[model samples]
Target: MIQKLQKKLEGKLPGIESWKRMAVKSGKGESIESESLQKYSDWISKDKLNDMRKAAVLIGLFKKNDEWCFSLIRRPMNEKNHPGQIALPGGAREKNENLMNTALREAFEEVGIKPEDVQIIGQLTPIPVPVSEYLIYPFVGVIDYEPEWVINEDEVEELFILRMSELISSDNGYTETWDLRGNKVEVPIFKVMNETVWGATAAVLSELIDIAK
Candidate 1:
């Protein structure tokens, strides 16, 4: 499974490469066909938003054995904002955190994934949702010997170990076509098992799917 991901997900990709590529499109008034990602290399490279909202890193840990394969998760429904949805182990970013650090911290807090156990090999592009006014970063991390995960019952309902082969072949996600204030918007979401992961999570997952597939 790890080898499979390494092929599907880049072992390494540059932050600035994305920005340079995006600049080309901006100059010609061409729409960005890129999935969900920022043209800017870093937070400082982009135009400063009136609201500088921060977000967390959603990490997917895939494990497989003789007959089982799954990714880690925390219940999104019943949570304050993104309630009862299926999602990766991540949350809001803390002050003075690098994007990678924020992801590691959130994963640890949400699923008891130790920072040392998970090795981050690469990251997906930045996903910013205008409605939420936050930029979300997604990373690909690997953990050997799945640790004993204890969900923070206060914030999470349970830990879902989702199968990968099934995810790849079965219903991996969803998409919604709607209009926001008369502007047509098509939002895509992922159906991981019974959980529906949408918004920034779905966008980030889309990128991972392209690179990893």
Candidate 2:
């Protein structure tokens, strides 16, 4: 089944235009189950969104022991925003680079995966992150071999290897309540490697899974 799914994914991925349409139709916060629904409600306001900082993340895929997998990083607790959160390999965009370059550069810096090794496939919806005041662009890519990750200990607390089969399984999704901004709210997340993945990271993955369908 995994091999079959992999073949299907390799056939034809949606292009940039499809990504744009998907971004608008992604249902924003309402699509992905999260505690911070209010912030995403205003995601469609182009004027306000344009004022926010820009960032990018890479959803990289590779094969391991005949199974498709991806990588996620746990941010160090001392970071200013989204401390100790589970995230894709990415960061804020630099002044001289495009979104794809930002994603590739950040992934290399954080995980030590060489930029040349990654084949840029496409991208998912661009989502606005209110807490960080940045509009994050999510790009999808694939590598032919497993990476020998050299994690930057200062920025990354730990590395997570998540399998595509687990992500697409019905049992992986769950709802849990957490105290956020003085309010106890219910957040939908994917349970992977005994960790809770929520917020923007989960939102992007949720859209990617939808696109795969």
Candidate 3:
């Protein structure tokens, strides 16, 4: 099953080259061969990570009827952060909230996903987005039945119910170009239906696809 998923989700979750290396060292502990440990080590290698903060996101996976689907949203055009970009249900870590709670809170705030409806399967290693100063802990969860979703317009421009089957499709999973720094850089991007899922969302998806598909 893992092999089938890995094959099916190949380019679907791109740019996990580093993560693939981490998984090769599965020593079975909190600090096994995983992105969490690697990112922490990478963080130490850099001098700026100490000034960073924590964040959390719910990698909420569910089924619409019998078809598997995941929630996505385009941020409002007016937001100061990663605005107008496609992303998962998550946000900044508040002063007193844990990562799990932050995921739950952000889900509700961004969309209308009820906290109790999600059954958390487990957590993925925290991925550090150094440029954003956010160390994102991506938690994977499942909802038994797809709930009718609504978008909070103040934060979400559009609420998308993307079928996982389509996402895992061989051709749709590919990379694209980005104008970063002073050069035209290429980044791993996922194309599903009419939307493009990339950046941090794609990065987290890369780990999840590597782990469980």
Candidate 4:
């Protein structure tokens, strides 16, 4: 199963065009909206998306114990933004860097995956975060072998490994109401590794799940 999944992913990634189509079907604006995170989309009307700071994150895949799996990180509670939130491995795009390079560099820095070891398959649609004012680009990549994770303590609280099967399973996706900034809002979330994954990270993963199916 692992090998087959690897081949399907590495053999022919759906790339940007597919992502654009999927974006229309399952991106932030379509599938990931919530009352609390709605502020993250408010910037759309300002026509200043290009002016937002750029960032990137990686959806990394690998085989573990004969099953196909992916990775996510829990941010440290003391961090300034999205502290203690579940997120993909990535960060701000540095000067003179493209989105792909930014994703690779940030993944290496936050999760200790060597850049050369990652085989980038394709990227998903870029989404905007109104709260942080960042335009985030998400890339999907695979490593042939299991990685030796050297987590950065300052940035990542711990790592979460989720099987693709679990992510795509209908049983794992559900909604719950939560108090956000004093307003009660219904949030769509995924149950992974016993953690509640919502917001932008969940939004990006939602697109990947649709593509895998």
**TM-score of every candidate:** 0.68, 0.80, 0.75, 0.79
Over 66-164, each residue of candidate 4 has an lDDT whose tens digit, in order, gives: 887878999999987698999999999999799899999988998888889988877776777656878898888888887899899988999988998
List runs of model 4 lying over 4 Å from the truth: 1-48, 170-173
* Candidate 3 C-alpha lDDT tens digits along 109-138: 888788898876667666666457687877
Return whichever of 1 and 4 wins on TM-score. 4
lDDT of 2 by residue, 41-148 (tens): 454443565677899999888899888788999999999989999999999999978989999999999998788999877777677776787889988888899999
lDDT of each: 0.58, 0.74, 0.68, 0.74
Worst 10 contiguous positions by lDDT, candidate 2: 18-27
The per-residue C-alpha lDDT of model 4 at residue 194 equals 88
Deviation in angstroms for 60 in model 2? 1.0
- Winner on lDDT between 1 and 3 is 3
Model 3 C-alpha lDDT versus the unseen true structure: 0.68
**Which regions in candidate 2 have their CA more than 4 angstroms from the true location?**
1-48, 170-173
Which pairs of residues collide in model 2? none
